[model samples]
Target: MPFLLNLLLATAAQAPADYTEPDHWLCYPGREDICTEDLSATVIEADGETSVVDFPTARDPEVDCFYVYPTVSGDPSPMSDLEADETEEGVTRTQFAPFRTVCRTFAPVYRQVSIQGLRQLFAGSNKGINPAMAYGDVAAAFAYYLENENDGRPFVLVGHSQGTNILTSLIAREIDGKPVQERMLSAMLIGFNVAVDESGDRGSFKNLAPCKDERETGCVISYVSFKSDAPPPQDARFGRPAEEGTEVLCTNPGDLGGSGPAALDAILPAAAYGTSGRPPAPWVKGQEIKTPFVKVPGLISGSCMKEDGASFLLISVDADPDDPRTDDIGGEVQVAGTILRSWGLHLHDVGLAQGDLIGLVESQAAAYRAKD
Candidate 1:
């Protein structure tokens, strides 16, 4: 008994908690930092024509979107600070900004495990402090949001990569099977693995199921995009079922099992560049654009398939061979160069399917409202 007590004390000492509630976040109502208005973008048509697409600047939205960003923190520490940085701002502008058209946006700044810490976790050395701290902050921020701002309205949960990890746990712990589950329109958990049984029962979630169709409410829309020809690594971060005889959930944003090729819509950063800045023609390096966001249509197509014992969204571009804009979009990572093939389009998971996800959310929101 003495030895067990000593061991518990040692473990507790190693796992020190150093997280604080986020005093400032991106999604606070009536805050100057809230980015839900005047989202203008430059649209480049296939015929070399350019136009501006201005989104609806609605403030009193009927629904809400709660977003959690990926692991873009370059902080040398194990956990990131709650304050927003350039990486956070860039991700919000490029990824979450477009969703404002559908619902009011709320993003909490959590002390996520840093990139370095994630690497260490993946290496199987450090066990729990980083993720525990990150999730602690996320939970606190979420509780505060629900109690102070939710007002019993419906909401959509959005997350990517590490953010997905936190939301998956959050749903399992707090939302699934609870009364709040009815209020969940959908969860778009991209760039991460969500497992399910052979019968499609819960793996990571209890009551929530993978979205089988576009208009399915209270379900999950998730996938890791990869080129059709590229197979994921055996050690890929997503798409592997957690237990034997089960399959990872893969819902193709395009054609959600019922139709023709989905018309792809994309919103990219103003500083967007192809792999190593060698993208095909119309997309030139350092090209100036008029808007903070760039919208490209008919540039990509997607499907869901199983490969290398993992499920993934297969992305294919229909760019004309003669068109300079036909360059293949590559995944972005912190590797400082072209992302490795094994990564399998990790970076473009959100960008490539942004349009499909938005459409899904819109449809799901309507379906949820219809239930009332």
Candidate 2:
């Protein structure tokens, strides 16, 4: 009779039969028309200077990266269409494409619960939107990739926000404790709280523990970033250590240990800010007209700790007054006219520590290869 469970049951009862079909995928290997190489981003310096940065695309990649994107749909409907839209494109360009420097990327577009659906769910109106429907599509797509394209190779699983929710479930149901778990390099479930006990085991996942060190393979790395001085709100969606003996897993990408602050390798969309050097409106299409991504190194630092029963990654930045690199990276999440501070830096969860995440993946890939 739990609210979420009831809603999920309702959604399953009404889901269409074709919901799990793979032909409707937005990104797959069969689609030769889609572009998946020569990924690039524009770099913005603290002094208002700009330059181009390109990621390496491998021809015979040793590892594969299966990614599920966060909630980027603005459609009023409960579920998003399978086609690739501008929002999806923007997310991929900023979040997933950069991984091309390491593994061959494979992203799947599912009928994810839309922005409106998320609002409704948080507002206590499930409206028969079952996240399982979305998970089904992801599961099918992942299975297809594993059987057809993976060829028994080691792979990494990446997801953000809603995508994280789907991937978490997928790992629990499909990957955990199975033969495929041996080939898993790592799972980057960002922008979401993954619960664990004091010993770093027992919640969210049965065998997969938090990544204790950077090169730790087959482990999970998850965190929600917030301002260094800001504590997560009591009602925050993420970082809430729900049970009496539980702690929301917080593995700072900048510093794996719950130790001192470390510098961030910030990557963002060039269009995030306008020509006038002001933060623009959401989906302001024109702000970053030419650049697909913008990298600002040494711009931020973060650390992980527990505050008021909530665990989170606290971020900090020292902006030079004379520098034009702009301190704002746009990672806040606002709901119902109120910004959720405890959710930490929801917007830039992946970008804030992109370099560290990529580095971790590369190391894990090498480790896995060595063991194989």
Worst 10 residues of 2 by lDDT: 273-282
What C-alpha lDDT do the candidate models reach, one value each? 0.70, 0.73
- Kindly report which residue pairs in candidate 2 clash with one another: 46-324, 46-325, 225-345, 233-342, 271-288
lDDT of 1 by residue, 283-351 (tens): 533355767656667877777776668777777777686544535554545356555666677767787
Model 1 off-target regions past 4 Å? 1-23, 34-38, 122-124, 127-129, 259-261, 273-287, 334-338
For each candidate, give its TM-score against the true structure: 0.86, 0.86
The residue-level lDDT of candidate 1 at 198 comes to 71
lDDT, model 2: 0.73
Please give the lDDT score at residue 355 for candidate 2.
Answer: 81
TM-score of 2: 0.86
State in Å the error of residue 325, model 1.
1.6
Clashing pairs in 1: 281-324
